[model samples]
Target chain A: MEVEGMPPARLREPAHRVSPRAVRYWTVNALLGNVLAWAVMFVIAWFLPEGRWWSTTLVWLFVVAMLANVVEVVVEPVVRYRRTRWEVRDGRVFVQTGWLSRDQRIAPLSRVQTVDTHRGAVMRLYRLANITVTTASAAGPITIPCLDTDLAEAVTAELARITGQTRGDAT
Target chain B: MLLLTPVRTLGSFAVPLVLAVLGVRRGRDEDPWWLLVVVAGAALAVVFGVVSWAVTRYRFTDEQVQLRSGVLSRRVTTAPLDRVRSVDIEAPPLHRVLGLAKVKVGTGVDATRLELDGVSAAQATDLRTYLLARSRVAGGDGEGAPAPVDAPGRGGTSYLGPAQPETELARIDWGWLRYAPFSLSSLVVVAGVFGVLAQFGDELPIDQIDVAQDAWRWVVAQALLALVGAVVLVVVVGWVVVSTVTYVLTWWNLRVVREGRGNLRITRGLLTTHSQTVERAKVRGALMGEPFLLRLVRGAELSAIATGVGTGGRTRVLPPAPRSVVVQVGHELLEEHGPLTMAMVGHGPRARRRIHVRHQWGTLLVTGALAVPTYLLQDLWVLGRLPDWGPPGLLVVLGLVNALVAESAWRNLGHGLTDRHLVVQTGTFMRTREVLERAGIIGWRIEQGFFQRRLGLADLMATTAAGSEVLTAPDIPLDLAVQLAGRATPGMLDDFLV
Candidate 1:
């Protein structure tokens, strides 16, 4: 809350939590992917020689993986949706997300390279869009997924405008 | 004046000659006609070199230098003189003998865009002076003359040096010679010398040589008492000698100076001289690389990350120096003292626990992966089987070492924040501390892997346009990461509630 022209303690703006559709979006994405992987593991385990040390280890691993997937594909998405949030201010962008390891990221509006919006099949069905904010980082772009389409568009336009103002200006 | 340069022809021939010699190596019954192949390769190389030299043509325009060169496909390169960041002239021993030099014109964005190899010394100097003058004039901030033109009648119209008033900042100190052996360069030199000697081992005539024979005899006699001790002593002595020689050759008479418009002009070399001008405006920050051995001796090297400046050797701003001197030089170059002098804030207990866990898990996984396979495969091989307890004992030792290193690494993890800069301290062996201006940070990345997420930890990376382009703070709590990112560039995260 050290933004320019703002008081230090006043106006503690709460983060905008992502829409609930994100939970459904991520849960389906995770379950479909993990189920297929788990099936392959189970098939491999079934074909293993019985009562051997390696086979027994495989069985134990498969069981652990199943439990892990249950948490990851089902319970994790809800917590993740609750955690995912983004906020736009006068000259910066702040995003926070993560269920187990929470990440809070802030990008100065001056350094914003580009703001892109996209809608996949699932997102389109849910009338949602994902806004990806790209900076000059090789780690990849910052994506805010499963926001309402209108909100996503508004954020994109606002970011583009802010970045345009600060473009080519030295710090 | 427009004739092909002889040095270019020799350079082109070198690769083919080496390949031809390698192909015609001493013993190969199947290749009795190797001489024919070698001759053909050399002839081909000569033809290609001649053609390339003949085709290449360059001319100086009013605002740009355009070079066209290609035998089949016409490749034209246009370098704007005003944008020229550096004009480096290099003359190896052979080129020096022939009074020729290689000129490299760098714009800093694309690094070197034009290289005029094997030009006469006079031409190289003229080009360097003409290009550098225009670049300095363009960068002069409206304080100097607009531009200086080269007169056709005069042979050497302008002095072929830095285009502005210069002041020497630092030069090679003989006292710093002791620090050379501790650098990685010494290890490289030792390794290279060993490789060459090993390659010619059969031709060495060791028994025929009196000194070598005496040395061997001494080694053998010493080995009777303690073989390992004798070998270790020889290695240590050899390492010191090789390292010192390498350091002297590379850093002899090194000079760093200030050029026009906040540009640093560095010139250093033993046999082949190198000069480069670095614009400080493009510099994001400076990093101090302190290797384990160097740190123990309280020594470090400084490098700055600037746009278009390649990392590693290219970014080096200061040679190996004591901590106090390096810090002073760094502060002077950067013109900021806050970030360099700020006290660092350490990570929490959870971060330490995470590091410990990671080390433990890594040790377990590696031992489990390697030891089991080795044991199982040992019985299949005819060689002697390892003792049953060996793998577990080795694993325990490795685990202890890993634990110790993990604790040290966790202790080293810290970050410092000033009003206009952020400093991140990291590294396990080669400890690197980077001081970057907050204004240079373009964006931030927050990453949380599954295990890290489970521990409520995250890594926040500040993305910039200079150096390796990313400065990361790993294993910090989510709340702290938020606060840190906000504090790093104050106006950026005002609306975010952590």
Candidate 2:
């Protein structure tokens, strides 16, 4: 990958991993989704006539779906939790996320349009919340998913204060 | 105002009117009960329009412009005068005939408009000038107020007067019409005509018509090759004529003028005239687009990347015209020559190879998928079976086409940085060179797929509030991407950069 007169492409990882409880939350979410899908598959299988060509195909598909779901529930959450990192410093927000395919975003505080927090029923049970920092760019709001509820609130307040102090409209 | 209501009502009921007329002709002896119903509807519409007009009260103070309307459920919309971004004056054919125009006051916020329908043309012009002048003064550029020119038809008014002199930036060249067919806008028009015809296909006596059979017979009489050539020639000529007419209708009397206080006023359209005033300060960049066909002819189109303009905030500044004209207009609009005309740094051999691999892989996957189905279904139907060489032959031709596209895409893959703008050019079919102001970039997003990361490449996107929202420099060296972001914003990315 080395090239003449070209510096290596590298980005410093952001500070602070998401709340550890996010792994548990994600696991439960994945399990629920898997269970619902499996239920639908079972219902379809039950109605299938015996010895049909597709009956065996559906069974193999069911097995593959189960294996994939197992990995999603057991492995992906932990990997995502370890990879996701975010920081609000130097009047800017930096977020780095994803396991295999990574993305790093940097948005200045002056460009922050709104800050909000969300706590779903499952998130509430895990005492976790998600904070969304929005800018005028249509790329969409930056979601710092699965933080400790209090930490999420504090971050939202801090972002709101910093954005409020800036003068010009976010655009 | 009284005439406007009935005309609008009648216009909306045109389909019903036609059906009623046909019904009357079909059954002349029957009572014309539908006419009475139509009269009643018109009367109700008139009453509603009159009452709404009478109830609507609009007033402007130093701070805000307030409009209060509605008889049953009162509503008030107030926009701060200082925030007024643009004022558009439009007069459709009916409105023009009635000497009335629609005034739309934009506040730069998305989709929030204060519309005054059916105002006297003179009053609409006055409001536009007054609002724009106030916005300019309030913006505090220190230029003070523009000199007020007397309104053409109206004599002394305290609040109504046209704003300062305008300098014409560009006018319709007529010669640009040659590039219209290449633009493919007429293809859409032609498709729309066919779509409408297809919608009424069932009603038309197509099955009973012998024209199609006669055409087939006529084609059979001629040499197959000659018939194909004639059809192609006819289609191409037809497209050229249709596109030219479409271009003329859309861009008739097109003018881009720089008005006092730096506002760019774009006035165009033939039957339904439209005049849009773009606040100069809101313009963030310029986008020059060269479609594949247009590029072959050395033609390009230009657009202003501004807030609260056209959809996605891109207002066309130049119709498809000579590349030289586009470049000149782009430079003028951006107030910078380097970014638009500078030689851009290509994304290196790795990016070029990546494009080839991607396009070739895609072509292979598509052809493979089709070949597999064709092979499997060979016994089921005669048409399902391809000849021994057909699959490979199709693949080779498609592969060659994709290779050409990949080469063009790779060549177009470049980015440049000027003192004030970050320029990124990419795309194969519609090659776009975006010159985005560094100041307009609000954020940066660096994305790397697994393979891209392995290859030390990343897609660097500068997120902005202007046209398209994000401009991407795809598959640039990761370090270069970072450097571009840091240099463009100067210290914004310092802490994050390794």
Candidate 3:
């Protein structure tokens, strides 16, 4: 996008995508959340009186939920997988994520305080891991999720090595 | 040390003791079970205080200061002398009466707060000077050499002697008290007072007071307009008095001083004096606050954006004062005039139109919500027939107010870049101009929502460890956002830019 009297500028997509297996992992996560929400609605509907205005509302809500469940499980994961990207260069780590609302972050290696790899139970089952790069800023750690475990480990190690080579305190 | 335990214990439990005594006096013949509980709690507190005091031990070595305490599970905290960022001394009313002060050592880390809870006031002063001096030596020399022990005024016994040379930056001015009422801090105090009164209304003898009864009768007799005028007059007078008193109690004798080693020391408070020190190297920026009311009177407040200083890592450098004085102090704090005085680049017409649309939509949503409920309830017998014009009138008034707010917000939206600092201004009610050092920025975050993307706009934030963590320029053109981030921290975003 360009503004008057200013040079046109743009940010290129980061170089790497998360592992392909992330689609399956995200699908399962979304299904689990949908099931829990649907179960709560069913329980409420069971207690509600029949032939009331709310009962009809609940029936309509069920239809909406079924359609939303399809979108969440079938469509969101694929779009998220396509959009998420990350890259680590000479002195900086760049991240881009989110399907609907795009976000881009850049943190210099000299300012990096720590790096860690995390794997949840389901992620472990899928052999996927997440890497978190923390800096002194409270905007919070930059997370690259659903990477192959070995790739996550390599990224964490590389980040640590690069951050360690710098001399000043992170803050 | 042992004698201080009971005194400190009783001081903290004074309110409970009074309540217990009142309870016993009211029920002369009844069992004093609650009093026993109160006494037992006080005794437990004293025992814990004594035991903790006995176990606590702190020792300062050439390289590190270590403190060890705890009976069941001992934990030792050690901080390197070179990393020391500040040393603060505080004396509450009771502590001052006992000639004792509490010393807190900050190392620019949030978790570990090394505190000496109770030390003789004189000893506290000596310790502050000695520790700060050692930190200065270690920081300036870039070596872990032991600081000299025989420096003048370093000895613990000579605390009453002349202090180190200091340059005064600012001090409290009585003329600034005029700005207190405009600050509206007294409204908070008044609300708190009303809340407490409500909580204990039944226990008080307010209804029995003849003067209160007479006042209520007079209020009921007055016409509606006269009553409103009287209430407003009372509120304005009360607000002026309360805010002035609060300002004096909080900022009496306030002084900002620069010590020989460049540490900024701020001392203030009447009953509970506070002495805070901020390391020169840790200072990242300055924030100039111009609340709408204060701005009308051409006044502003200044605060320091420093690491590990005060709550939220911000230290008030000046109270509500003249805008010129605020600018002068800000210039001194940042050690430059360009960032504070530079002209800001506005976000242009697109951003202004975006804010107007957002605010108008908000006004429409609120009006619709309120109108639906009011319309539904208008014919109900219980509420009496409501006026037909209420909803539309509300829409007209709120729409006008929000339009003004949107215009003001657009005018306030601007950012500037100086050689060493990036300045961003935001907010409407309490507009703030933040001048943050480019060197302090650790990262950049560029966010674009669906609407923002369609408008080719983005919010650019610079993340740092000091003061609020993130400083943002909202609704700027996407290209300008990228350019600002790239130029602020050279080469940090170059690899990602196309």
Best by TM-score: 2
Distance from true location, Cα of B393 in model 1, Å? 4.9
TM per candidate: 0.76, 0.89, 0.88
Cα error, candidate 2, residue B34 (Å): 6.3
| Model 2 Cα shift for residue B115 (angstroms) | 2.5
**Per-residue lDDT of B440 in model 1:** 82
**CA lDDT scores, all candidates in order:** 0.72, 0.82, 0.82
Residues B382-482, candidate 3: write the lDDT tens digits: 33354767778889999999999999999998998888899999888888999999999999998988788888789999999887788999999888898
Model 2 CA lDDT for position A57: 82
Judge the docking of candidate 1 as incorrect, acceptable, medium or high.
acceptable
- In terms of DockQ, the best-performing candidate is 3
Writing each residue's lDDT as its tens digit, candidate 1 over B1-498 gives 122343455466778777766766756757658777756765665677677788888877766778899888899988776567566677776777777777777664453458777788877867766676666555553354664556333665543333557777778888987887787757776676667655765664445545556778677556545744654566678898887877776677788777655667677778776666655565678888898889888899987666544333146767777877778777776777756556668888888999999889888887776676567766645322656776687689989999999988988888888766789888788888898878788777768778887776778788776667788999877667767777786666554542
- Candidate 1 lDDT at B285 equals 82
Misplaced by over 4 Å in model 3 are A1-6, A43-51, B1-3, B22-49, B69-78, B136-165, B194-227, B374-388
Q: Can you write out model 2's per-residue Cα lDDT over B297-410, one digit (the tens) per residue? A: 999999888866535777878889999988987887887877778998899888887788888998888778778657766665654676767678878999999999999899
Of the pair 1 and 3, which is ahead by TM-score?
3
Using Cα atoms, each model's DockQ against the true complex is 0.32, 0.55, 0.64
True contacts kept of each: 0.42, 0.64, 0.79
